[model samples]
Target chain A: EAGVTQFPSHSVIEKGQTVTLRCDPISGHDNLYWYRRVMGKEIKFLLHFVKESKQDESGMPNNRFLAERTGGTYSTLKVQPAELEDSGVYFCASSQGHWTGELFFGEGSRLTVL
Target chain B: GIQVEQSPPDLILQEGANSTLRCNFSDSVNNLQWFHQNPWGQLINLFYIPSGTKQNGRLSATTVATERYSLLYISSSQTTDSGVYFCAVGDSNAGKSTFGDGTTLTVKP
Candidate 1:
């Protein structure tokens, strides 16, 4: 089966600009998640979605960051007025509805905000 | 939020050598997973071991939930084994995990 896939493997944007990263999860998977890792930092959870609704988004850094799962098949994370510290690798992962399985992750989209 | 810490932030070993990586968490977890991120930046799940032990090929992992720790064993390491190992812990119900900083492993041939 095809694993989770992310678009625009790399993104470069000026500070204060807006950028969006997309992720297409595994077929039939009901759980989708977004995570990010800044340089020299651990990978941190951003949000979780079950189907088309968000399950938990407590990890969202701020209001400038937004994540949405449309139609429950794919997800998109957008950063508005991006700051230099927003540069990092954003990863998308998915698993079954039960959420007991290992998370299948994408190669990650590296965002560079200058 | 729970706290996760990994030991030996970095490691370097020759091919054919064995190494152990440790992870300690501050609270109880119902879900624990091991992941390997290759140099290309793909995070591949190695094990979903919350307790007990599991083995896959030359790599194995053991999670002592009672002690709130886990260990990943790499035997007969190879150049291809070079990457970052991350330990993630969370509850099975929520599926939101907090990850450790990871152990960067470099295997030299």
Candidate 2:
């Protein structure tokens, strides 16, 4: 089975620019999640989607960051007017279930905001 | 929110040696997972062990949920094992999983 896949494995943009990262989860998976890892920091959750509706989004950093999952198959994280601190690796994960299932992660999208 | 901490923040080992990485969570969790972040920045699932013990090849993991801690054992380590090992845990009531700072393991050949 195909695992989670992300696009634009690496992105470089100037501060204040906009960049969008996309993730395609495995087929039939209902739970999708987004996480980010800043340099020298732990990976942190960003948001979660159960099908097309957002289940939780408490981890979103600020108003400049937005995430959407339309039709429940793929997700997009957009950072508008990105700041230097936003440079990091963004990961997307999916699981068959919410509570007890294993999570499969994608090859992270590395964003470098300078 | 649950907090996950991984120990021996950094480790270096000679190939063929063995090692153990530890993770401690602040609260009871319904999901606990170990992942290896390779040099290419891919998070590969190593184990999904919330309780009890599980072994896969030379790698084994044990989670004492009552004590809120987990241990991952790597036997006969190889250079390919060099990477960052992260432990993530999720509370039953939360939809998201909290991750540890990760243990950076370097296995020298």
Which candidate has the top score in DockQ?
2
Instruction: Mark the 10 consecutive residues where model 2 chain B has the least summed lDDT.
Output: B89-98
Most TM-score-accurate candidate: 2
Fill in the DockQ of model 1. Answer: 0.73
Candidate 2 has a TM-score of 0.97
* Model 2 stretches astray by more than 4 angstroms: none
- Residue A67 alpha-carbon offset, candidate 2, angstroms: 0.6
Is model 1 an incorrect, acceptable, medium or high docking prediction?
Answer: medium
Candidate RMSDs in order: 1.4, 0.9
Residue-wise C-alpha lDDT for candidate 1, range A1-114, written one tens digit per residue: 888999989999999999999999999999999999998588999999989999899899999998988898899999998999999999999988577566888999999999
Model 2 misses residue A87 by how many Å? 0.4
lDDT of model 1, residue A53: 93
